[model samples]
Target: MSALPASRDDASPLSARAGLRVALPIVVLIAAIVAWDLVVRLNQIPPYVLPGPLLVASTLIQDWPVLFGSLLTTLWTTLEGFVAAAVGGIALALLFNQSRLLEYSLFPYAVVLQVTPVIAIAPLLLIYLPQETAVIVCAWIVAFFPVLSNTTLGLNSVDRNLTGLFRLYGASRWQTLLRLKLPAALPYILGGLRIAGGLSLIGAVVAEIAAGSAGAGSGLAYRIAESGYRLNIPRMFAALLLLSTAGIVIYLLLALLSHLLLRRWHESALGKDN
Candidate 1:
């Protein structure tokens, strides 16, 4: 026989790896669901106490309208907070990079905000600000520090030789910042944003839970709290599942964006095979 053509899998190890990567998670998830269902059946567990995955799925479908509305509310708040954190953090970081005195004066306050638990701050915020605003502010406070810290690090990490070269070529401060510092910092900034995306959701949830206690809001977290009070465990699980899915989607989207932006040049975005 003449030489055979290479099989698709033989030709593309990366493709095989990618397929395995996706398939493994799906297999694991299916196995987990099957095990959960079996445990519920074998033990005669009540739905209220531990709803099976199937029951939760049905419950999610049944309550889709209400749950989805709450999800949208929570997502909107997350977006607002993430946007605020991105803009404010980057702007502040730029300012800090330019002026050591400004950084010294303001950086401590940023740290204080980051260290203070948003759960503790939520109640006070709810008291002083409108419910929606308080929730968004909490999200912003939780997310802001990572972006500020990361961008600052990236800016400072620009090579000293490159900095000197830019100065040697008579680059203005703005030119150095725009051309050299910002490009060097892009990876760090994107990494910070990936973290911030999930954190913004968490902060919104915490705030929503706080607001829910006062019978105020309609975010998914509030729905979770409401379901708990009613002992509607299936609905609670459904709401939680939605929240988890939302967070995962947000993270994946940011990660994809970062990869798309940096893949041309950044080592972090490159595949191992590359």
Candidate 2:
């Protein structure tokens, strides 16, 4: 038999193509920012209504301490909530995967929790718990469902052939889960993580908006509200820009982590041939 040619996985053409793909978005972002700055400058818009990028940048530079402190608080809260959600969601997903009866009984409750509005629940949580705890709980509620749903799907998606192989090997349930199902589910869990990362930040901000900030625990959302009330438009825009940047950073970080983890073996982590 004749041998076929090798596949081009690491050639210059492939690397250059990937570089171009990455460069395209960055170029678009720079163009958009430039266009936005030009439009604001040409229109001579009032800072109170629509601050130019320069004004927002100046405000951010001037209020670095206050804004950075608030950003840290928000980031901390989101990280706490997201971590808790990731752990709890995976645990619950495993439990649900163990039995169809349990899944039927518990899955609806999870859906109900997910459907309940965080804004509506935040007030009640605040009344019942400490402010920080309330905020964390609210954030967890908002972020948990995606992880739960995605992880559950991953766990259940094991191939029947694999399941039979594990059974033939006399694998215990736990052994099968640890060695087979969990590995298979990693991409799905990471997918949920990417989504939950953004949701966690949003949840923290929304809870802060609904419940208001307590001393020593205020976040960027509180700063935004404070700026709006005081008519500090430039400062508000600065806070908003920080929040947007943080969200984007969180998403990109999770995506990169997912790609790194999957790149060794997963098809989804690799590019397709044209």
**Winning candidate number (lDDT):** 1
Q: Give one digit per residue, the lDDT tens place, for model 1 in 31-100.
A: 9999999999999999889999999999999999999999999999999999999999999999999999
Write out the backbone clash pairs for model 1: none
Per-candidate TM equals 0.95, 0.90
Off by over 4 Å in 2: 1-16, 213-217
Q: Best TM-score goes to which candidate?
A: 1
lDDT of 2 by residue, 145-172 (tens): 9999999999989999999999999999
Instruction: State residue 217's C-alpha deviation in candidate 1, in Å.
Output: 0.4
Report residue 72 deviation for candidate 2 (angstroms). 0.6
lDDT of each: 0.95, 0.90
List where candidate 1 sits over 4 angstroms from the true fold: 1-11
